[model samples]
Target: MKDKTVAIVGGSSGIGLGVAKQVVAAGGRVFIGGRDAQRLERALAQLGPAADGHSVDSADDASVAAFFAAAPAIDHLFTPGASYALGRFMELDEATARSPMDHKFWGQYRVVRHALPKLDAQGSVVLMAGALGARVGLTGAAYAACNCAIEGLGRALARELAPRRFNTVSPGTIDSELWRERPAALREAAFESFAQGAPLGRVGTVEEVVDAVLFLMGNRFMTGSTLYVDGGYVT
Candidate 1:
């Protein structure tokens, strides 16, 4: 990662922020884009001189385009920015059910489309997928579809974009900032449920997922693949 520039969308918080910190620590520079101005500021402060960023909402094309416009040539790109509702298919309204694809899938599509001009020919792209895509359940039908779609996109793009690697990382429940805002009881219960299903008998950590991201970025031979960091939950 030395001297490489990694552009991470949705990088102000959660796993994206964790990736940025690691990239800096490994002698790489980062161009981080996120929706929250305050969080982006906080991340920049924590990252110090090694990082720079822009305010970007993945749901908006103009915002995403502008964000990438400010970045220099990018050696690697990661899109972990997405927000959507999760529920049983029958219980979800049209908009709510479609939100996952609308935001998570297309948001990444737009980021990658806009990034092509600056993305290095030899660089890699790591798209975010989730264990839900593989492990089916009563609810999360829409969320699972979105993740599966992303994995498909990663595979397709790897062929279309050649030389430039593209892969998806599917992580199970992780103890990360994404869960920090939830009520304590809800968080604990969810973790416990996920842990019981996994062979590891526990949820994963942000560092664990970030390790997968860095591996995808650095592995030249790994393209059009899906790396699962699900603690065997999808096994």
Candidate 2:
């Protein structure tokens, strides 16, 4: 992976940052894109010299196109940004539910559409999904639909890309700020619920998800695969 260029959309935080760190550690150059300029700058600073930051709203086609245009031939592309809207199905508003799909679902699609020509033949694309794609329940209509769509997209891309490798990483409930934002009791209860359901008896870490992404990116032989890093949540 030495000197390889990696572009991560929605990489300013969470799983994306974890992957960026791994890429840099593996001697790869990483460009991270996010909507938050300050956060992107901060992440780039934290990632040190091997990382570059770009401000991009993945939901916007123009922004995504410009971002890919500025990025050099990339050896890997990952988008870990599909998170939005969590409520009971009955309570979900149209805007809340559809926003994630518009931003993350189509956002990832746009990235692939624009970046495919810029990828090396051996390059890989890792799309982020979650156990929700397969497990069902808990997450409301929005997340369920979005994750399932992501998995479907991964399958299609893998088939179309053929030797180029396209795969999906489905992580379980990970310990990230996204969860921490919830009320303390809710967060604790959620974690406990996940711990009980998973055969591994615990939630996942950012690093664990990152490891899966790295494996997918490096394993030239793997494609059209949906890897569950969910500790048996879907099982």
Candidate 3:
């Protein structure tokens, strides 16, 4: 990846930050766009000299256009922003139900629309979804639907985008900030329960899922495909 240029949306923390670290380690130049400028600044500092940070809100048209307009044509694009929304089908308010669509689904819609023209011919794109999209749980209809929509979009885009490969990655039960809100004991118990259920006996790490992203980045032949980086949670 030396000298290669990559752009990552929502790259301030979690899996995005992990990708930034890997990009720096591999001697690649990475530019990450995040909604939070302070967080982005911290992330870029952590990533050292090879990484750059930009503030981009994928939901707003002007912001999206400006981001791609100012961004250099790149070898790869990664859109990893996901909105938080979950509720039972009957109880979900219209606004709550549409939150994921507004951010997670349509946000990528905005990113991909602008990124296409700016992408290098050999460039690839990796869209991050979730395992819940492949299989369902007892709740979170909106979240699951948004994730499913992302995979669908990636498949269609792979064909439409042609040689610029597009793929979706579905990560299951990752150990991330999503669990940080729980009390330590509760969090530990939750993780253990998840581990007991998965055949692999544990949840995934950010490193594991980021490895999948890099694989898609490097593998030119893969497109219109979904890589499930779950710990056997969906299988």
Report the C-alpha lDDT of model 3 over 106-185, residue by residue, as the tens digit.
99988989988889987999998888787666467888888999999999999987888999999888887666755789
Candidate 3: the clashing residue pairs are none
How do all the candidates rank in terms of TM-score, highest first? 1, 2, 3
Model 1 lDDT, full chain set: 0.94
* TM-score of model 3 vs. true structure: 0.93
Give the per-residue lDDT digits (tens) of candidate 2, residues 2-27: 89888999888889998998889888
Each candidate's lDDT (Cα)?
0.94, 0.86, 0.85
What is candidate 1's CA lDDT for residue 5? 97
Best-matching candidate per TM-score: 1
At residue 101, what lDDT does model 1 achieve?
96
Report the number of clashing residue pairs per model.
Answer: 0, 0, 0
TM-score of each: 0.98, 0.94, 0.93
Query: Candidate 1 at residue 210, lDDT?
Result: 98
In model 1, what is the error at residue 113, expressed in angstroms?
A: 0.1
Local accuracy of candidate 1 as per-residue lDDT tens digits, 161-190: 999999999999999888988889989998
Between candidates 1 and 2, the TM-score winner:
1
